[model samples]
Each structure stands twice: as structure tokens, then as C-alpha cells.
Target: MTPDLIILADTVHTLDDRPHHEPIQAVAVSGGVVAAVGSRSDAQSWRQAGTRVVDLGTATLTPGLVDCHIHPVFGLDLTVGVDLSGAGTLEEVRALLRTEAANDGEWLRGWGLNPNAFGTTPMHRHALDDVSGGKPALVRLFDGHSALANSRALDRAGVHGPEEFDQASEVVCDGDGTPTGLLLEAAAMELVQRHMPQESFAERKARLAGLLRDFARSGLTGGHIMDHSEESTALLQALEADGELPLRLRTAPWCMPGSGEAQWKDMARSIGTGGRRWSIEAIKLFVDGTVDNGTAWLYEPDTLGQSTAAFWPRPEDYTAAVRYFASRGIPTATHAIGDAGVHHVLNALESLAETVPADVLRRTVHRIEHIESVPDQLVERFKDAGVVASMQPTHCTHYSLADHSDNWSTRLGPERADRAWRCRDLRDAGVTLGIGSDWPIAPYEPLPIIADSQLRRRSGHPEQQPIAPAQALTALQALEGYTSHAAKAAGLWDVSGSITVGKRADFTAFEMDPLTTAPDEFAASSVLGTFVDGEIQFMLERLG
Candidate 1:
């Protein structure tokens, strides 16, 4: 028999098997689909002379890790921006600004510069203003919930200052009530983002080409992309046309509809995947700001003393919006982070559930992103509602990284913090928790997440308490969070989550047994290769 590709993995984590099944070996692929799986001899039967066989030494192989909550656009933004991730203090930020400004002057692009991510005090906008001097520089607050713009950027964006829009904006004001350069929430940042140059289709194609390579290095061959912008949609079209995309891209394009099912249907249809190189299965919406932003909807009234604001329009208003998509047969993925946010969404979902059929509710797979904080009451409601709790483990571990001081914990209170990003509890409560990286916000790697879930230790926080050490998940559980279960939540169960026969031969090759490795050992383990449809995309070691 002539086969296309044969990979004799040293070990395979066949996640579908109960007893959970350890170390199976050898998989064959043909026509870009997984052909068979069995003993070495059985797999060898398909190994004709032309079959390109890869006997990957002793590396463990499994279905490609699927990150269900990443922003493909963030990766693109990072490639073109001023990066403050390496700067730890105001001085470093200034020097970075100074050096980057001296060398280049094109819209000071930067990302991952969360001063809070370094566990320090938030940098004042004046520090940024002083450095860039006259250039338009924008620094994304570590959390991605807000950003700090220099005086020039504020001017270029035509806002001058946040004081101009206090009704909706939360501009950091000095004692004098003068607009400090810091812009909170959507107030100060929207203008700059609006004015930021759009990536041409060619530039976007090249950016995605590079991003595909970046995906391979990080062990991510499958991701659910929240790329809803027009430029973003066009980029996917270009990649599909050029045949440049090499990962499982499940797109959730943004759609605005009042009620007519035809409107959403036509809109979703307009952004065609062309030939399914990608899938635009769901519609994306944000019901509240992130937990740290003090905007996640809450029911018990924020015990942390911060505002327990719901991140959506009027519940009834968005309820209709959610139902509009539901009626159109499109799955809806919402970003709801707080308990009130949960309740806000639950009430909306239940109201819609009464009109929508049970099986349709099941098929809709409406997911709540972040779900950063959940009260006991909403957990059961979430399970019964059939809502998928789309979580990012890095969000669990790196959450406090976004806080400069202990403000977030103080805001969340210790008890609620314990319940923050509760993976094990959600699983126990029967909530479908799909794990992700929320990358560039955090690295697009799973090891740190595994470390966080198991170790519960934050960088530079040997003294600071972790949000919830008790809520930690085990290694196998964390792995599953990033693998099969994640794939299931992203609506990719039929394709790539586990190494089942007849699925795509997409997978990752690893150096150590993540299941057996010591918690810290996860940091040492590396991705030898990342494969998509049996073709190696990015690899540190050769496939064979």
C-alpha cells in the first residue's frame, strides 16, 4: 500500500481511551487525513517505498494542542509594534522609548508591556510622554483591558486628554483633575486604534505567514481565532487564497444584527472560508470588561469595592442580540468574566433558552470567555445552560501578573480570588471549560499554564499569595484543558484534538512526558515539532 506520510511516534497520548491509555505508537496519514493507528508492524503495512516515514526518536506525540481563546490579531499587532514586555521599570520604558525612537519613528508600536505583568507599580503616562518627547507612542496596559498613550498619541488621535470624555471614559486624573496621560477602559485607546494604519492584504498575508511559523514554535497547531475586523477577515481570505494558513483556524467574526436572521446569515456567508481552510462558526461579543478592569458583571455586588458592572449593553438589549444569532443558527461566544457577568449572561441565555429548543441550545455551545470569577449558584446554572466556560490557564496563572500591587486581589477579595479561574471546580460542576493562552497577553505556550495550575506560583511572587492555590488543576487535567477538551469546545472534535484514527494527522512532538514530569520539569520540556495535516510546520528537531 502506498501511503503519504507515516509518523512512528515514540509515544502517543491517545486521549480518547479510558484507563486513560498511556504511550501508544505509530500513526499513518494520507490525503491529509489520519489513516490508521496500531502497533509498529500494523502501521508498517501502509509503509510502501514512497511513504515518508518519521520515527521520532523518543519524543511524545499527541494531537496538536488547541488553544481556543487566542487572538490571531494580537500576534499580528505584536509583530508590528513597540514592545514594552522586557521593560521592568519606568526607566527601562523610557530607555526603550528613547532607543526605539532614536532608531525608528513609525507609530511607536509595542505590546506585552504590562508594567503590572512585572509585578510593579503602574507606570505613569508622564513617563511615556517624557520618553517619546514628540512621537505618538501607545503602551498596552499589561492586561489588555486598557492602554497608556503619550501626550502626542493622545493629540494625534484627537482626544487631547481623557477629561474631555469623563461621562464614559475613566481617565486617570491628577489631584488637579487634569487629564493624566493614562486612559482607562475604552476611552483613551479607541481613537488611537481607530487611526492605526490598516494592514494591506499583502502585509497581512506576510504577517500570517510569519504567524504560522510562530505557532509551530509554541506547540500551537490549532486555535480559535477572534479576528473580527475587516482587515482581519481580508487577511484570512488572502491566506486561504494563497494557501498560506497551516493551522486549524476557527474564526469567530464580529456581526451586528438586531433580529432578522437573514442579516446575520448573509454577513456570516459573506466572509466565506472559501474552502474551509478556516471556519467562521461563531459570532463574538464582549459582555463585560476583564476581571481586573472592574467591569465584569456581578450579582452579589462587588465585595472588592470596585464596580461590579456588566460588560454588555442592557441585558435585555444584548439578550435580543444573542437570540438573533441563535435564531440564525450561529453559535455565540461571549466574553463574560464576573459572577454578575455570569448572571447577566445566564439570565439572557435562559430567556433565550425558553424560546430555543433543548438540542439547539446544546448545539449552540454558547461559551463564556474568561469566567474569571464565579459564585456557587452560577456554576450549576452554567452546566445546565450548556455554556462552555472558555478559560485561559495563563489567565489563571498570569492574572495577577497584570496587577502592579495587590489591588486586584484586594478588589476580588481572597475568597473570590480562590474561585477565580477555577478549572477543577468547573470540570466537576460539568461546565465545559475550554482552555487557551490569550496570548501576547501571555505567551502562547501551555507549559506556563501547566506550571501555574500545578505549582500556583507567580513570577516574583514568592511572597505574594497566588490567586487560589487550592483551585489548581493536576498535570493531566491541565494537559486535557489545552488538548482534547479544548478542541471539543472550539467545535473541532471531529478533526484534531486527539490522535484518533481517520482524524487529521496534526500533532505536536514533545521531549518529556508531561504527565509524568515534575511540575517544574514542564519548563524544561520543549516542542520538537508541530505538524499540521501530517506536514511539519515549525520544528526544532527534524520530524524523523
Candidate 2:
């Protein structure tokens, strides 16, 4: 039988997890699944009139990259406001905000304000007020762990001074006990965010479309969303219903600390798995905050750390939540960054391993997102418990400068800082590590991150030293993180992840072999094409 389509490439890394690698010259696709994979001659025999053939000469093909952690809806919303990503200084951030404020709007919103951009100068509400023109303005820090609100925004949110939170969140205050207009973590940030105007349904759909296109252009065929909102859920459903979704999406609705089993069952039934393209089979929980804001639940207090509280005011509630979800075959991805936070999660999983049924354990798929700082003992625990370590390589490159000078490194001091992002250790210990970009917090391209994962240095910043050079991974190992390991992490290994004959033909074609390319060249490499379910999703140009 003639195949529907044939793809020919100079080289193909199937990432099959075998002991040896083989050269794959062609792949035939029919009904969105790989029908055959062998030499170019085999595909030529199957070709006939009306069968489309795409030849990517000298280009390399691999299974499509999967970002195990991202917030597509939130990232899209960040782009609609003032993007402070490139603003190197606080003055530059203010200038950009001032320019955006000039437009007609009730409130001004912006994102990607890195506290590292401030240098020695402290961030205050007055700085944002100067550009707000008396309008309420809220600009989130790049990490999404904190935000800066102007005086008007603070007043509107009814935040006059420091407010206590059940979680580790905080409303920043001055020496005089006056509100500083900065809110740390979701609990506090939502106080001001609730006052902002809501996005219309049409606007949400447009943003979703824009986000998916961006993902395709970046060589992503699918992603796992870390958090979900009602608006995001509806928008994804609306787009898929309209046959407009371009990438596969699986999401986790946020599960707070105090929520009981009843609430968990309700969320699971109402929002889980809308269709093949959209799913909400997991729940996202925050065990602790980020390192930058000093909110991480550390083993020892950070150097002058302001927060050492767990995200859940009650730690037992977190264990119960995990148990409740795992019992019903739902996964829980806890945002655990600090060593203490990671330990808390590991303890719970270790305890539950004995009681949960083996089949349920296999299907439960519990994972820890951003295991930023962990000891050797916990790395082994991850392997023993069969938990996936969903990590972002760019977190080290984009946030920590070598020599331990960056905010993230400085917070932990030399001893603990050296253990930043134990990617190599985790992989060596047989823990499945899945890579992602954590978009909006960091750049969301797999190529640059792959380069960073291998090199342990920022792509363009050659002057900055490598962070934890010992944690660097091999190119093949890194590729597996996005392909095979990522699929295993998302519980979709049986159907996706590799270019095997029976698997779906989801692939990312590159202009060159990322595994063999020079570090500098690899970071700058562009995608030749992206395919999902045997259909071309994005292509640079037609090949003869």
C-alpha cells in the first residue's frame, strides 16, 4: 500500500533507549502514525502518485520535544503587557512601563521584571507609582513568585500594610510598618491581581492561538501545563472544539493546602481529560516558594533569608492531598525547590508506597517539579519511589551566574549553592529527568536549553562562569529528557516519545544534529520543521 506521506532526512535520532544507535533514512506515515522506518530505499518503494514526500536534506530529525512544565496561558498573558525581559536595569523597566501606560487602559499590567536587574537598589512601590500616573499597576517578577504593585493598586486591593498568610506568602512592608507594595507568592499576588480587569472570551482564545503558534515555531509538539485556570481550561476546550489547537496540552489544576478529598474528587471529575488534545488528569501543588524571594523551605535558613515557611501552612494537609489524588489514579506535581521542601514530598511518597496498590502506583505518576536543591540521599529516593523529576535547565543558566554571585546562588551560600539543579546526579541514579523552559520565567526554546544543559553556562554570556559544571548532562541524555523521559514523565510513553514504527509520528526536524553541533551553533540553531500525528505543523520551507 502507498503511504500517505514520506519523510527523508540525512540523519534521525530515534532516541529509542537502546544500547546502540542506527541511521534512519526514511519514515512513512499513514493516518498520523509511523507506518515504516528504514533505509531511504524502503520508503521509495512505498511511494506512489499523490503520496507526499518531504526531504530534509542534511537536517536531523528526532521525536518532537516535550516541555514537561510550562504555563502557556500565564505566559501568553505576560506577553500582552509590557515585557520587561530585556530591560537590564530598574530604570529601563520603569521606562518600558511608562511607555505602555501611555496607552488608554483602566489599569497597567506588566511582567518579566527580574529582581536581579535592580542590582544593589531595592525594588519599592514608589518606583512603580512614579510610572502609574495614579492608575493601579501590578508587575510580576520574572520568577512568578512575587510582584510589585503601585500605591494605587495596593489601595484598590485593600492592602495597607503587612498581611499574614496561611501559606508562606507575604505583603512586603517598610521599616516604618508601611506597605511596600510588593506581594510575594500567589496568596499575596492574587490580592492585587483580583482587582485587575478580566480578559474576555475572545481575547483568551486569541492568546491561546498565539501561544500555540509560538510553541510550534520553537519546535515544541506538546507540553505539560503546571497550573490551570478556569479561563485557560475553557479557552483550550473552545479551541480544540473549533479544530484550532496546534499542539497537544495536558494540564494540572491547582490544589491548595486546605482542600479536602471532596474538593479533590470534584476537580478530578469536572476538569479532567476534556479530549485527546486537552487533559487535566493531574493536580499542581506548591510545597514552597522560589529561591530568589527567599521563600524556599530550606534545610537551613538562607543567608539573611526572609522566609523559610512551607507553602502549605499545614504540612499534613499536603500529605493528605497527595494520598487522596494517588488513591484515585491522579498524579500530583508538587512545586518543591528547597531541600526541605523536596524532603517533605519524598517523605510522603515513601510512606504511601506500601499502602497504594501496585497498579494504582504505576498509574498515579506522582512527580516533583523544580527539584532545584536536593542531597544525594533524596536523589536515590526519587529512583526508589519511581518519581519523575520535572526540571527546567534554563533555571540554572538564566538565574545563577557562576562563581555564586547571582541572587539564587548568593541566597544559598557556597555549601548548598554548589548543589544547584542536580540533573546529572538524578539521571545517574536512574531517576527520569524531564526538561522544560518554565516560560515567561525563562526563555522557552528547547535548543538553547539543550545547549545550556550540556554546557552548564548561559548561551550568549560566555563571560559568566558555568553553574555546577559537574551537573552537566551529555547531549544524548539531554535529548532523551525532552523525548523519551518527558513522555514517561507525562504518562504518554506507550503512544508517543520516539520515532518507532508503531508510534505517532510527532517529530521536530532541525537544520543540524543538535547532539553533535557545537555549543554556540546549537544554541542558535532553528527548527526545519515540526510534525504532530504525521501532519506537518510548522516548516521552514519546502524541500525538493
Candidate 3:
């Protein structure tokens, strides 16, 4: 018997569950599965005619990196528009917008706008109109929870006055109850977005294929995409049919309150565990909005004691939806950012577990997206409830400050701010952590996220203090969060997480061993290559 592909690396981390394991020299792959992992000499013995061998000198290989929560399609759309992610001041943002507005497109769109960059200066419709040149425009804040729309965009969407919503969404209003063009939450943003021209199916599919390739280049073998839509589903289906999908995609369709049991039952019946490359097996729900936009459902109000509403106007309806899905052995991921929001999700899952059988519960794991803030009692309940904390380490590195000086800290105050991202506490409590980049909200690369998890410091701003240094995880633990732990969260652990024999031949190669490299050194590291099912998805080209 001969292997189809053989990968030789200086160090191969299997990340197996065994107590002690030796570093392997080579990995043998056959028929898209890991056939053998042992000494370099042993790998040579299995080689025969037609077996492809690649030697990566001084490189370290590990399980393919998995970003448990991401929005590949949505992120790509925003990225292709004006990118305000690098703007450090309002002038910079305005300059970028001016250039974008001059383009031929009917609507001017941009993403990654952080309000803090403007200092105390207010952000209103007129500010965007000044640079937008009267063209309709919408710029999303870095959080994706809010967006700024120009006056023309507001007129186009016919959002002239305050409107009522069933969720915690808000359209900023002036003293006269006139729309101010600041859209809070998805529901509110959709008002103006509904007026934007829809992309053709062909365009959507083409962009998705391109984005998946980019994801492979960034060292992401797969991800648990947060939301699913008809267009997104069509794009994935087309890619899978053409064999163009380069990464594993697990999507969770949005499940809102008042969607009804019939709709859920039908959705549960239609969606399955998916094929080898992509699938939809989970439902995504939002218990509250983002903390930055003053929409998060908090036990106590924010610094100004404002935005104390839940995403679902009827909290009981959300609880019922969770029970309905959990009882059917389908996983549910709730975006809960504040203490009250986290508590509500936990209570629902805990109550449903009372009647749901152990085997049924074990079949699918319930997950909480962004356990931003939680009390000690709720933290202890995560393990018992069998919940997977699908968290983004970059959220901390990019948003919070250790000295409780950042906007996030100021909003929560010192007491709650100190407890931000208790990753170490949750892990010590025996909880399985699924870490991700939450792309579009932050950077999409996994290496930087893994490093930030260890250093607990912002990626580029070393001058800023680290946020909750004690909450940092060890390098090895951080790796598990992206590999083994992330795979389990997506219910693909048995087939893809570790480099165990019989698993898929998915691997990510890096210049240095992440487990031993200094956190700061991660910035200089480069991705050597990425493989999926024994096939090279991406490889660096030497410039020499």
C-alpha cells in the first residue's frame, strides 16, 4: 500500500488527547485521510510510485485552523467596499468616504468605522453626507451591530421618523423624533439596506469562491458561519457542486422570535449534518445587541444607564425557540454579550435540559456566542449545561483596555469590566472553549488571535495595557481552542480536529511552532501552506 501524499515537517503536532505524545517527523496521507504519522524513516517505507512528497524545512504542522464563528460572504462584501478599519481619525474616514463616493456605484458602502476615532465629535447623517456628496451611503461600525447612513440613504429607505420594532433595534432620532441616520442592530440597519441594490446570484457565487480561497490563504481550513440566507445557501451549493469550495463551512440560519414552531420544524427537517465540505445544523439567535452600540441587554444599565432592552421583545418567545430546537437534537448559537443576555440564554438551555435526554443533548451541543460578561454563578453552569463558549479572542485585544479606560470599560464600570472575557476561568471550570476571529468585527487571521489569547494585549498598540492578563490562556490551550475545541463546537471533531490516523488530511503549516513561540513573535510568522484532504489549498511562493 502506498500513500497519496506525504508531508515532512520539522515538528508535527497531532494534538491527540493522549497524556504524552512524541513529535512526529512525517504524516502520510491516502485517499484524503491521514494514513500514517510516525518517524521520517517509517514514512519513507510506505512511499511508492505516484506518492507525492513535500518537505517543509524548519516548519511546524498542526491541525488545520478553524474559526468557529465568521461571516465569510458578508465580510467579503464589506471588505470589497471602502475599508475604514485603518482610519485613526475622523478626517481619515471622511477622506476615504470622499474617494468612495466619487466612484460610479449607485450606493456608497463602507465597513469597520469605529466611532472612538472621532473623539467627542458627534456622528450624524450630515457628517456622512458631507463626504458622500449627496449619494446614498451606509458605513458599518467595526462591531457590525450599528451603521451610519447618509441623509440621502435615509431618504431612499424612507426612514424619516422613529419606528417601533419587536426587538432591541433602534434608529437614532433627533429631539424632534427625526431619523438621525445611526442604525442600531440588524433590524434597524436592514431598513436602509433594503433599499440597496441586491447582487446577482452569479456575482454572489463568484465572490464567495474568491473569499474561500482568501480564507485558505489566511490559514482558515473551515469556519462556523454565523448566519445563512437564501443567497448564501445558493452560493455554497454552487461552490460544492463545482468542487470550488476550498474550506469546510457550517452555517447557522438565523432564528428570530415569533418564527413559529412550524417554521422551525420545517427547517429542522430540511437541514442535515451536511456533506464533507459544508452543512447547516445549527440555528442562530440573538438575545441582545452589541455592547458598544448601547443595545446589549444588561442587568444594570450602561454608564449612562441606557439601552436596557433585549433583542427579543418577548423574552419568553426566545426561550421557547431554544427549547424547540434543542428538543429536536439541533444545536443553537445565541449571540449574548451582556451579563443579562448571557443569563437568559443559560437559563433557557438549563431548563430545556431537564426534559431532553442525555443522548439527545449529547448529539448536538448548545453554544453561546461571545460570553462577553457573566457572573461567577453562570460561569460555573456552562460546564454542567454542556455549553460551548464560542468566543473571539480578538474582541478583547481590539476593544478592551486593562486599566478600565476603553469605552467598553467605561460602559461597564470597574467591577464588571474586571471580569471581561473570563477565558481562563471558564477553561478551569472544565468548559470546552471554541475560539474564533469573528472576522469583519476584527481581523480574520487565526495566528494573531492565538497570540493575542496568550499576551492579552492589542496586536499593534503595545503602549496600551493588557486587558485581564490573568484571563489569558497558555499557547497550547489557545491552539486547542481553534483546533480540537472548535471542531467539537461544530460537531466535526470525530473527523477533522486532531491529526489522528483515519482523520481527514487537513493541516496548516507555519514557520514556527506556535506552542513554543513568543506571543509577540507571531506577528512576524508567515503561513507556509494550508492543506485540505491531502490537497494543497494554498502555498507561499518564494520571491527569490
Write the residue-wise lDDT of candidate 2 on 1-544 in tens digits: 6688999998988877654334688989888888888778878798989999999988999999988888888776565588887888878998999999999899988888878888867788988898987789999888888998999998899998888877778888999888888788888999988888887889878877877888998899999998887777788878888874677888888998767878888877855656767788689998999888888998889997554788898988999888877877888899999999999999988778766788888876789999888888888899888889999988988888778877788888898888999999999999889999988788888899998998899886678688889999999988899999999998878889998878988999998798899776888988888898888888985642
C-alpha RMSD for every candidate: 3.5, 1.8, 1.9
What TM-score, computed on C-alpha atoms, does each candidate reach? 0.88, 0.96, 0.96
lDDT of 3: 0.86
CA deviation > 4 Å runs, candidate 1? 18-23, 78-80, 115-124, 160-177, 186-188, 195-201, 255-266, 270-274, 300-305, 401-405, 458-467, 542-544
In order, candidate lDDTs are 0.69, 0.86, 0.86
Taking the candidates one at a time, how many backbone clashes does each contain?
A: 11, 0, 0
The RMSD (Cα, Å) of candidate 2 is 1.8
Residue-level lDDT of model 3, residues 1-544, one tens digit each, is 6899999998988897754345688999999899999878888798999999988878899999999899987776566579998897889999999999899889888999877777667678888988887789999999988999999999998999887776778899999998888999877989988888887878878877877888898888889999887767677878888884777788888888558988888778756755668888799999998777788889999997865888999999999888888888888999999999999998999898687887898888899999887889989999988889989988988877777766677778898888889898999999999999888799888888998988888655578678888999999889999899988888778898999899988899988899898877875688888899989888888610
Clashing pairs in 3: none
Pairwise lDDT winner, candidates 1 and 3 = 3
Off by over 4 Å in 3: 19-22, 273-276
